[model samples]
Target: MPGRAPAAPRCAALVGPYLSGKTALLESLLFATGAISRKGNAKEGTTVSDSSPEAKARKMSVEMSTASADYLGETWTFIDCPGSVELAQEARNALLVCDVAVVVAEPVVDKALTLGPLFKFLDDNQIPHILFINKMDQAEHTVREILEALQAVSSRPLVLRQVPIRVPGKDGDDVTGYVDLISERAYKYHPGQESDLIKMPEEILPREQEARTAMLEKLADFDDHLMEELLSDAVPPKEEIYQLLSKDLADDLIVPVMLGAAEKDAGVHRLLKALRHDVPGPEVVAKRLGLDGKDASAVIFKTSNQQHSGKLSLARIFGGKIADGATLNGQRIAGVLKMKGHAGEKVPAGNPGEVVALGRLEQAKTGDVLTASGKTPSGYKWPDPLRPLFALAIDVENRNDEVKLTAALAKLCEDDPSLSFGHDPDTHELLLYGQGEVHLNIAFDRLKNRFNLPVKHRRPSISYRETIRGQLKQHARFKRQSGGHGQFADVHVEIWPVQRGTGFEFHDRVVGGSVPRTFIGSVEEGIRDYLVRGPLGFPVVDVAAALFDGQYHSVDSSDMAFKTAARMAMQEAMPKCNPVLLEPIYAVEVAAPNEFTARCHNLITGRRGQILNFGAKDGWPGWDMVEALLPQSELHDMIIELRSLTLGVGNFAYRFDHLQELTGRLADKVVEQRQAAAAH
Candidate 1:
């Protein structure tokens, strides 16, 4: 193994909670590996990651950024993913193709809960990941406490790879270096350079020994020989320890935690060295993804629409090689471009394990697997796009830009599948769905700056229905005289309330031809038209109308006269039927950490929800799923509040269950709003 060649070019994703310094870590990694001449600051808008205008203005990553570097003669590509929860789907898509992920975190116990969803996703997919505790220089809590908090959320066991070595400073103790737990060696940190090998400090020797023993025990759990050696009080050889560490990490049985301060370049080199040795190559990931490793295949993880280049599909080659103008998945490749953030260089070909942009793959979308044969491999799986939790009713300021807005939104949704837009049939609004408000705001910004189409957005309207409680029968006559032929017709219609959810029903119960068969159809058509806008100014449902009898003039009676007569009858009878508003109720299942279960319950109940049941969320440790029936009107901003309560890790899925009668002040307010909008 020692004499073997370096592994193929591998990819790693840097993922963590918001403001956890993933971009900073990416900069440090790039600068340390000589990919960049100088490290860039995210705050100063100089970082290679977060290069987009929206990201630079917000100083946060809104999408994933890809950059490649060379460390110890091995090529590595690192994807810096946005840490905000709203952009988590972007991170998940990038993680699907990577060989490993670096879960960056700050040394704060309270903020550890934010990593629950991210950790669950990595473990659930068996993706190998390392925990890098960034900003160790500003640490307030001990490393053990931080690890403990993280372990509660992670399903995999966390093993400490290094223990920070602190030295006395003018104000307080400073984390000057770290002691390697496996190698039993101490190194002193040097800013902007590799660490220096130093003698183990006697004062921290006991702590270092304890951490080393614990790491060894964790490794022994996966290896019988290592367990035997520990039981016999024999020290395992360094080679054997390294082998177990690599194997266990590749197997995703354990997460090795490393300490670092990316801003100062402290521990950055050490982190890179671990990645060079511990992370598996792309071949292993290819097998895990069920790729045959024989065909010319690539999986698209990200898509971008460039003004000049058109559509660029960022894909990781899984097998064989792809050159410019090659055919893949029945589509001709326009060109191959090597991507470094938003910029790209024309590449003649893309090889296995290298992430590159496939030019002009207009049909290719995120999570699409492309092969030369134009067929998807059997049983291949890709992560589904995350369910949208927030939405807005969007419209163009200039009606002339409607077509451009649609095209721009299509491109945006292609670039980030987490974004979606559609026309609501009931509400008749163009709704843009996404993870949160900030997520959609970034989309709005893209429409204005990238596509030259400015848009306006507002909260979406709820689809409220109107139903009747009482039954009534009304008679009406339509008579008009203007010329030689006069229009005259009479109708008697009975309206009755049916069971909830029965919808609208029309029946012709006429006998003895009291109303002619030709005119009866017209009478029912008028009733339906009237139902579209009920007396309460909403679509009417759960009602039945029957035309039992009517009179028709032999000479002047026509379809229009009968229809007008039926409409007049309904217009007079519906007000006496005691109309009521019917609001849609959804079966909502909220998933959150058990610690916040009580808060979730309060959040639901405070919104006029009825709890149905609560239980443990299957396959999710330390989490609970609370099921409830909540009205549609209460769910507009529920995600915003749920995240605020659960540290942005909570999410809910809901579907329309039934329609319930909505009475009282809330119903009155809804009806008033509907009538006012109708007048406008």
Candidate 2:
């Protein structure tokens, strides 16, 4: 890969929905840039972005890939990101370091909704983005209709800057030409090449010229001089129209929509020109972050595990300057890397808006802000990960690998923010939570492939606890006659319920010199330990107990005798207060197509879910958010069924909602498990 990275590199991210041609677009870009000799298609399973075994097998992108290309005297750094919602974190992270977002969308209306969430994110971040209306070569709708569909859903103004030239007497199998609104000139395709050179077309001059005038009018609205010329019925100059675009684009005042065919690599060169000249960079982002451009500061975007490199923190400097081997945020990092998809090289220094990598940064975390020698670190917050949608218990395949499994899984989570890891305290299950079923499976596959950490996954157990709701008192006596001495201890206790979630409480009320002070402490300790598990074998909580009176044999009575007596008293008292099973409830929210909302509602109801409310949310196909209280036990199967019902289009997530009563068959299962665990 020598001489791979050309001197001037423009990094961009290829992002869109699954099967919307993201990988194919990357293949075309690679071939057109001469990085590869031949093009590979996603269906053919030979694209560079899908090079990973898992990706090739599944025919999807599992992570973001970086590649470099030399086009028109510029080295374009392209990152191909997955379109699946599960793997969108990789795409989002890629956007953080890059200056431009070339949003790819199809010509049809149905597939356009998938771009909703991505566009919202870019808009919120004020990222300079362009709309690439791909698949124009076989578009189902006319150019005007496609533009209208995009215009309706777009939050920002999407102005069309390129009009496709339909091939005359052709089956529309190819896009023969295009008109650039700014230049007011036609670009006719050159056979055997990806793009065409600018030349005025002879076949369609008047119509194209008229459309160009209209585009100038749109551009004129952003510029006073152009607006004045338009009012006077004078056509704005071509240079004047382009000059206004640079400012409007940087401000995100307008998003220029252009047509392209990724298969033919027709519009890629135009997109590259836009990136190098139209899009803004780190300076724009740094100013928004309140960072002084002269101050040294950078943000880590992605972290990867290497065989010997330890941890590679891929970052982009936002403000100031950074030199290789320089200290940042109290740790020394390896050299800076100027990234290409399949390759990268060490760099000596980087400035604001420069995409670079730090090798083996010990203390650096993704989204962490690092500053140069004298600069202050500030203003980079990581995107909040999507709520964990699916969870499964994990156990190491080999007992010897248990420690390594934990360490390796932790590293994997550190690399992807959407993942969460912890032990379910009530169930005592080691659970890993992620965005969805496919999300978790991909993560599992990566764990095995990348770090060789093998693990078995199962549905996590429901977390439960035991509590009492009444008051009762009882007496306990432990008397035994052994060889050394007879152990005798008698105790009277009162047990009552506190407010919910108060946990266990123990008190000593031995008054009037009834029980000795030394024995009283032992009684409390014994009761506390016994409260660890109740009659149903759940951690006993929200109950209070007091030792009212006791008698002990001075010669033989000791802590053990008192301990036994106290435990026996608890056994006789807690159940008398009517212990009940309390299960953890999750606040579940389901979003799906409106047609499936009824099915979702019925599904939630069947799962012992309480319908809290329902409403709409953004981006989903007529999305309905069903707010419900669902016990954690039934959630696993509910998710599986919901996905099946919607044909893998339904998505939902839940958090610890509240603890609710568990009085029926599910509670019976808890009791059974408790007995089995006790036997073991």
Candidate 3:
């Protein structure tokens, strides 16, 4: 018989809170599968997953790293997401491409305290996931103690799959000897030699026999054979137990807890073997994507710019084979490689159970579908990041770097969704916003280190507008004589105030064509262009201008002539109209801890905020959302104080409310600082 068709490549996302050993686990998995010569330590900056210079300097992952392993004749693609909430969207992207998730959780009481919201996120995604309590070697507590802590934060049933046989040390400390629940065998780790598995140590076997029986009873509840074997004194075959556990794990029926020292590879080889066998393959994930197993469709999970190769679209092949020279979305692509971190070999086979990179795919983006062009493929949409803190305004000092900066930032943003940069129209600042301060800092570092785009970060300037306090009539005449038909245009215009947000308005109030009809429109264009640089170095707004009178030379009064006159007239009239700075105000919604109400109230009042309402909120304990209209000028540094008062748990979101008047030194500062920046 012909070989059975392979299943879809299975995908699993690795995510957890900050510093939860996610990187270490990937390192251990890669090395144990013989994919690498030696495992790299995250602290030593030699880890395969976080090999970027930014990761090395910060000692944390700023973006998601995609890698694959082939073991037991099965291929598994895994995503290692940044642990910080700022970059947690990396995990979200990982989930989009995967059928299952591995939520790496530290099995410690204090560490498990913040897993409530994260648990809800995973549960909501409907991605069957297992909880791995990593770093078991250094943890002071036992596996059971960590399980109970997780049980308290989440309502999910904490099932025991493996219990570490603790061996006491001389200082009254304990080290894990073997997993007692998996089998009755005992494991002894020798310092220099490989581990030894022997017949059950008679003394310790009895000590864990009761717990072993309880664990088997739970497993038997799902597998009928185990239940029958339990009563009949016929022990269930180990293969049958593994099958049931694997099925339930894939189905999200029950989560199996596994323990291992991610650094030492203790219990790691067995864990990865099980994952390769049990984790849903790409074929299965394609089913989850609502695809029939023919033709290729894969989500672009990552995009990286390589030094030698321009752009590498690292993706998982969901259905069908992606061979060399296969057309994607009607575009013929070149080269595909099965990646093991930074090193990958050109592989012709892009099978269902594989994680490969389609190099130099021009049409691909982070979430783009790689299907035959014009085919509607079923896939989940990318999640929008909720970035609360904005930081890092980057622009290059070198003129050449400035030319490359936009393209470089685009590639970086394509790689990591949490990283974003653009120019603010009102402030004229190239603003970069991210999940937090550290996040954008790392992004800037990557831009400089990886692509050699040297950039710097500074505070984003507050965006404000300029409007008139009262109407004023001003006339400007431009008469120049240099050659034949010298430029000459004279105009009289009236300026009036509109509602704060009515924007800019222009009307033709002339008769008999005092100014030629052609020049009339040119006058309005000049006024709008002048608005970008207003009297106070801001965008001019909420003012109406009308052409009441003008004189023009038919030959001399060209569009350029009227444009120059219009600029001069507006410049003269703005200061006389009682020009005032219009600063942006945000409609803020602050969900803060109740005890910080007084502090928040005082803080907002100090920032010129007008509170609309304040009341209690549901679902969150001791929290209230204070709705207010606050000036945007007051918001740049507002989060720092808000977080300080709330002990780092409070959060808020806001949008543009309106533009209001700016008086006093705040108005003076806007002009003074703007002039200073222009000078620089």
Cα TM-score per model:
0.98, 0.87, 0.80
Candidate 1 weakest lDDT stretch, 10 residues: 1-10
All candidates: CA RMSD (Å): 1.3, 4.4, 5.3
Name the lDDT value of residue 191 in candidate 2: 31
**Tens-digit lDDT track of model 1 for 247-306:** 999999999999999999998998888888888889888887887777638999999996
Q: What are the clashing pairs of model 1?
A: none
lDDT of 3 by residue, 253-279 (tens): 666676666766666655665566566
Q: What is the full ranking by TM-score, best candidate first?
A: 1, 2, 3
Better of 1 and 3 by TM-score: 1
lDDT of 2 by residue, 1-680 (tens): 01222333346788877777777778877777788898876766677777766797788888888776777676566888888877778888888667677888888876665676677778777777788888877787877787676765567778788887776555644567688777666787553364656676666677676666766766777788888998898866666666678678778777888788777777766766666677665567666555555554787778877544577787766656678888888787678876554356787976555567787787777777787553454544556766677788999888898888888888888888888899876667889988778888887887888778778999887668888878998999999998988898999999998887677788878898678988888898888878888888888878888999888788989889999999999988887878899988889888876767899889998888889888786554356788889888888766668867875557787778667668888678879877997899
In TM-score terms, candidate 2 sits at 0.87
Which residue segments of model 2 deviate by more than 4 Å?
1-9, 43-45, 167-176, 188-194, 197-225, 319-324, 346-353, 379-387, 588-603, 614-626, 637-654, 673-680
* Cα lDDT computed for each candidate against the true fold: 0.91, 0.76, 0.74
Worst 10 residues of 3 by lDDT: 1-10
RMSD of 3: 5.3
